[model samples]
Target: MTESRCGYIAIVGRPNVGKSTLLNHILGQKISITSRKPQTTRHRVLGIKTRDQIQAIYVDTPGLHRGQKRAINRYMNRAATTSLRDVDVIAFVIEAGRWTEEDAWVLEQLKNYQCPVLLVINKVDKLEDKAELLPFIAARNSEHNYAQVVPVSALRADNLTALEQTLDAYLPEGPHFFDEEQITDRSMRFLTAEIVREKITRQLGDELPYAMTVEIEQYKLERGVTHISAAIYVERDGQKKILIGKGGSRLKSIGREARLDIEKLIDGKVMLNLWVKIKSGWSDDERALRSLGYDDE
Candidate 1:
């Protein structure tokens, strides 16, 4: 048998550009949480894509932008930029609906790279027609000169096979980087945190979701119910008040939804108890970021 081709593919894009959605769709599982809000992703989440002769280890980086004045933000920004290097193939995902200066920033930086990159123009469903793709593609390619421009509607599952085919050719031949059956590189605890975080991102408004962090404090399986307790940390008491709501109704709702999602993700019954607390500038703290796995160094 011929050796399988294995390589790392980094999907880089600006915030809310559907990077996580693309990863989940490609994995055929919801390994990552996606939202319409900016900066919904904060870490580099790796999702594995395997076929008969290829294993694509994909790293989905946090959306690139000028970060908040905090260590964690810096750490996140660094992680996004760091993954750009040392990859066999790069996928530059664009929203296709909006082209911001940030997009230009990414394309400009990538233009200097010696490696091949596939420009993934995501969200084609938002477009009107194929003829409309020219200017958008031209604008980007005119600047950076991508290896190949492949349009894909990741949310709608359009042209993924073509995207995969391009990747298949670009990646180098080697032994598989991960087991063919594996989907993601994150732990259950990490996904649990992300599951809760995703719910928060969808339910809450303003900057509450970004300022918060979820930690699974206890997880015990008893009989049919996986009893779980999680702590949602915020930097201020006012934010905690909003999270718990009056009579703890909001917290209860969040718990029920998160529990249901956990049950689905783990394929087991779950009894989740969620509690919120103030961490006092947790996002800005280097220690807090490190503890949450956003290590800058």
Candidate 2:
């Protein structure tokens, strides 16, 4: 009989490189939220994929970026950095044709690591000239000795089977850390909050997305329906007004979409209540961050 194999694979990358999208597709579920905006992911999310005897626990980290202007940014950076500890494989994800200074910074952090680093070039489908891919891969290969190099489009779910096979080979032999049915390490409340946050980020413009967060103040199951009360917190009144929108139309839209997603996640009826609250400078306050469930590593 084959021995059970399980290991943690850290999916590291710069902001908006589709690390979360890659993880969601690999696990065949939407555990990590995604949006077009940079820094949409603020915490380290774990996605587990078990096949036969091999279990791959993927650590979907917040994008490692250079801008640490806010206290929350520092926390996000720390969360992503700490995910590198004691992992069997590192999947360094990046865009197909674009490389930035922040990407270089992420690579610099991986320089001293002892584990194998698999270079996953994501978003290859967006490359107007497919011919440019090989050269780009060749150039990046010369920079680091990757265990394996694979080009894929995480959004399109292209070439993911090959990526999985590459990751499966690197998993160390060990018993599974979690049950087979479990796909993530986060709680339902956390996921619901993230869903709400994703909706807000998608609806709002560039500046306000990063200035706000979602908190689930109540989650209870009664009879057949789940009642959820979530607070949308922003740093200022103007931001709150923007989130709520005119006549509460925008907030209703966000709530409607979030409720649908949450219901699908739980497979039950949902009564979601959303409210916009102003907590001045909450994004930059370490104490406020901790209270809003940002303390966990």
Q: Report the C-alpha lDDT of model 1 over 103-125, residue by residue, as the tens digit.
A: 87877767666788888999989
TM-score of each: 0.95, 0.98
Which stretches of candidate 2 lie above 4 Å from their native place? none
- The parts of candidate 1 lying over 4 Å away from their true place are 207-209
| Cα lDDT tens digits for candidate 2, 1-297 | 998999999999999999999999999899999999998999999999989999999999999888899999999999998999889999999999998888888999998789999999999999999999989999899998888899999988999999999998899889999999999999999999999999999989475868888999999999999999999899888888888889999999999999999999999999999988989988899999999999967
Supply candidate 1's per-residue lDDT for 17: 89
Give the alpha-carbon lDDT of every model: 0.84, 0.92
Number of clashes recorded per candidate:
0, 0
